[model samples]
Target chain A: MSTRLLRLLAPALLGTLMVTAWYGVHLWLDTEMRFLLPTPVQILGAFRDNGESLGRAALNTAEGALLGFGGAALVGFLFAVVLSLSSLVRASLYPYLMILQMTPIIIIAPILVLWVGAGLKSVAIITFLICFFPLVVNTTQGLISTDRNLVELFAMWRTGRWQQLVHLRIPSALPYFFTGLRIAATLAPIGALVGDYTAGNSDGNGGGLGFQAIIYSSQAKYPALFATAAVTCALGFIFTGAVVALSWLALHRWHDSYERADR
Target chain B: MAVPPIVELREVTKRFGDGPLVLDRLSLAAQPGEFISLIGPSGCGKSTLLRLIAGLSPVTAGTLRVDGVTPDAAAAELAFVFQEPTLLPWLTVGRNIELAPRLRGISAMDRAATRQRVLDLVRLGNRADAYPRQLSGGQKMRVSLARALALEPKILLLDEPFGALDEMTREHLNEELLAIHAEAKWTGFFVTHSVAEAVFLSTRIVVMAANPGRIHSVIAVDLPRERTNATRASRAYLDLVADVSQLLRSVESTAA
Candidate 1:
């Protein structure tokens, strides 16, 4: 098959295989333990029954993830630029940034809920925290890793520093930025879910997918829980697909990374 | 009658970062419209010399000037083609050609006109919209040349610009480069390891030794003004290449 057709079909094929295997496992299990495992039909029925509630939760999580991603991108890029502009700043500030990145977000999330109080904004902050470092590291590396020969060429032309940053550095930074964004895409939902579990309303519609996962499991509605997980996976796919689509738009024309993907 | 030399290097010395000397007390000069090629082994610092002439690197001592001004001050009059293609892969051919002049604050109209003319000069006028990744090796080098030309420079500094190409492409681009140089009438300083290329394209070839990279000998090429493949196939061109090759061998042995 052509690369495009393969790309389009691969996910659907994988999802179908996964559902089939889940159904198989459910059938093989002892009847006494079967109550803990939801069949594909049961999950589908749950989705049909509670579609509105789950979708609202997905929407809330999606909004928080989107906001967090935007904020992460903006702050991360600015921090990269500021740090990379001078070796002194990069040296002095880099350790602090690394420490921030290494600190456990799970432990911090509950404290953040207590400090900032609970809402979509708090979850968004947590997502931003998770998404920030990769962008900063990758963008900084890109900005600094301009080919030495091109650096000389620009220097020979006496192209000013601003032009170097805009024309040379920024264009070089793009593929790296996209790689970092792809990584952040996967991490973003996890962050949003963590935020929701710790801080979102436990009883209300505002608790995101993570909250839904918690609520359904506690209530022992195994089918809805399974359905919630499958739906969450779908939401993750949609979010990542949005990022991949934007990456295709931004980089398909020139970057080798996207060029290979096009193939 | 004597026209002033376009470039003059007097007792130039260069060392790097408290390391050993790269070029030591070296000196050379180029007149208007002369193609001078510097040939030496890998460690001979020939590329470093080109960088010094382009004002991309500084000399430790002595003076280097273009049109009787400091290399840094004369930057606007000089354009360099590196050993690599060096075209921004993200940019279209036209945009890449337009870039240097724009960075130099050239007016948009003038940049556009020069970009068109050089693209046409390099026989890439139709491919202005083509990105660097879409181009072949030779076409990318043509874009590199066109980029240099857009600056309307008086002197072109090329550091083995065609060295990366295969032999056939290299020879073809060599001819095209001579034609472009003849038409534009810019003084050219080229660095190459290939003696045949140096002999074929240069009015003068300067052989340099390694370990303090200084000129060992200079040979004046005796080829027809407008070189063709016939020039390469000619007895005199073969003799000249062989002669430069022998000189290069001797230099390499002495350096070793």
Candidate 2:
């Protein structure tokens, strides 16, 4: 087969095999135990019945994820800039930042709920905390690891610290920044869902997929639970896909990773 | 009365944080429009000398002056090119060329004009919109050269700028560089390993010795000022290259 055909066919083939295995397990299970594993058909039926609510939940989670991701990107970039300014500053503060990253979000979620009260605010903060570390780490590494010769070239012109950061360091750091963004992209939705699960409002109108998961699992709606999971997975893919598109838009013309082999 | 040297070094010494000396009491001077090549074995501090003159690093001791001022103070009058092209990959050829002027807060119109002039000087006028990655190795180096020239510097310090290029491209760039130098008349301090390159480009070659690097000899080239491909094959140029190579070999052996 042609490469393009193989590329498309390979994934479809794997998916067909996976669905067949899943259906076989579903059929082999005792009817009393079937609730533990909804067949693909049952999950599809759940999607048809709860499509509108699932869509709303997906949107709510997306809003929270995007807001948190934006806040993390802005604050993380500024923090990295500050850290990149001086070795003394970086040495003193980097450990504290590491400590923040090391402290699990589960341990901090309740404190966030108490401080912010359970709602979108807590959800956003939780998401921010989850996505912030990689952005700061990657951007700082990029900022510091600027090409030595380029730095000297800038220094030769008596380039001020600010100009050097803006012109040389930041541009050079972009590929790295995108790498972090992609990582954060994969995590953002998960963060939002976790936040919503722990601290979100229980209203039917605004409850995210995480809240929906709670409702479906409590009611023992196995098929609906499976559908919620598929939706969450799709949301994660959407976030990553957006980031990949943005990266291509920013870098495809110049970056080596994005350059076409044929070209 | 004599014209003052544009760059003067007196008993200059440098070392890195108690490390062994990289350049020891090294002193040299360049008249207003001299092209000086520094050639020596690896680790002889040819590059370090260029960095000191460019104000990228401070001298550990002694005095070095450019245009009657410290290198730091004279930074606006200087530019440097590295062995690698060092062109910002994110920027187009034109934007890379305009980088210094833009940072210096030159108005947009002037930046555009200066970019055009330098791009044309490097014979990359049509490639202004191309990114550094889109260009060949030689083209990237040309952009780097253009970027340095955009500064309109009075002193250009290049540390083995063409060392990574193939011989054919290296020779091509060397000819283009001399052409630009002839017109711009900047005081050039070039560090290189190629004897023929040194002879072809420099009015004076400073051969250095390693192990506490110091200038071992300075040879003046009596070839015509305006050089071309023919000059590379000329009897005088060939003889100078041979003589400099022999001097360099002797320096390396003794230093070893």
Candidate 3:
């Protein structure tokens, strides 16, 4: 591997090594009394045995995350447009958005589950609630931050509000909206996982990864639980990385932040 | 031959929010095809006076007219250039120039023709696709000038358009400005601080004093119609610059 690639991989490799060392201690502890932590080798074996089932569960979780994220993006963008266009709407609705943003996702997840019932709807609602705020806030700020002089220039020419919004405000808001989307994407997987835990079992029998975590903890299946967790963390990383790549591609044409910094 | 003044300001006074008055009872008029420059210190409200004429800001008290009508009524006949390059950073240079006529309900084909003509006039014909970021400061200012000219207004109000440029660039643009005015014959009221710049480009220079901006004197430049680099070295041009410099010095001393 190139030195640069190695440099990027070093931290992850070190973290894996430390985790393995910790797992060894857990195995030693399990031999004595507690079965809390599991050996890395045993966990990997459990992962291999359960790979097919876990992969299916991962797909289910990914579907919920994708649906929720896409839906929230559309809604948040519309809200941002409304916020920029109508000061009265912003004045009336901004505080409510702030409330939605600050409310704990863990607390909201159970309530969403109760209202929407089990399965995809509940999970999607939870993910959307978690992901919507940043998109709205960033997009609103971007739209509002247009150059006053340029705005006046358009006004002098008698450009209508709708035309200005279409040609100016929205294009200006793209980089900011994508920034929000990238952040939301990272949080999306966690939102779906939490929703699954709160909303109870899928098909009234199969515990998704999150409920499997709860069940494994109850049953003292430490290796299986640890394996499930490793997969969940991997899922989160994959989602977040995809968002970063997407954001980089989207804004690389205009914004400097996406450009790779020279030494 | 007997056309009236294109724009007239009758007893125009302007004050900011709860602040002191900026322009006090300023009365000025621009004859059709006349080029006038308003020169003063930084806080002399020359820009405010320009904005008054452009109808960007309402006069606090007294009549502000353009093309013998109120600015609101004469909207089609007035164009303004701000001190800064106010080109839309997001739009291409050609689109920025096309904005005014497009907003005025002109057809796209006509707007495109006008845009091309104005860009050619400003000598920015090749930079139509470039964004504002890709432009040099001088080029950006040129784009802004093109945008104003694209409106093809009878009266142009410029608020120190080349104030931000270096001395060489400023001098160069001053020559280009004179050439444009000569060809188009639009009535112009340009605001600036440089004495030589005002004398070189203007038919008449209106010198103002600070702290309640009012005209101190109006010096009519008697230089020849053809102002080349050689004109800057002419005795007549230098004498006019000296006279305006003396007026500015007197204003500064009186204020001090």
The candidates' DockQ values read: 0.75, 0.84, 0.39
Top candidate, metric DockQ: 2
State TM-scores per candidate.
0.93, 0.96, 0.89
Clash pairs for candidate 3: none
Q: Of the true contacts between chains A and B, what fraction does model 2 have? A: 0.89
The alpha-carbon RMSD values of the candidates against the true structure, listed in the order shown, are: 2.6, 1.7, 3.2
Q: After superposition, how far is residue A109 of candidate 3 from its true place, in Å?
A: 2.9
- Can you tell me which runs of candidate 1 are displaced by over 4 Å? A1-21, A24-33, A202-206, A260-263
Candidate 2 DockQ vs. native: 0.84
Can you list the residue pairs that collide in candidate 1? Answer: none
DockQ of 3: 0.39
The regions of model 3 sitting more than 4 angstroms off are A1-44, A85-88, A203-208, A215-224, A245-250, A256-263
Higher-DockQ candidate of 2 and 3? 2
Residue A49 miss distance in model 1 (angstroms): 2.2
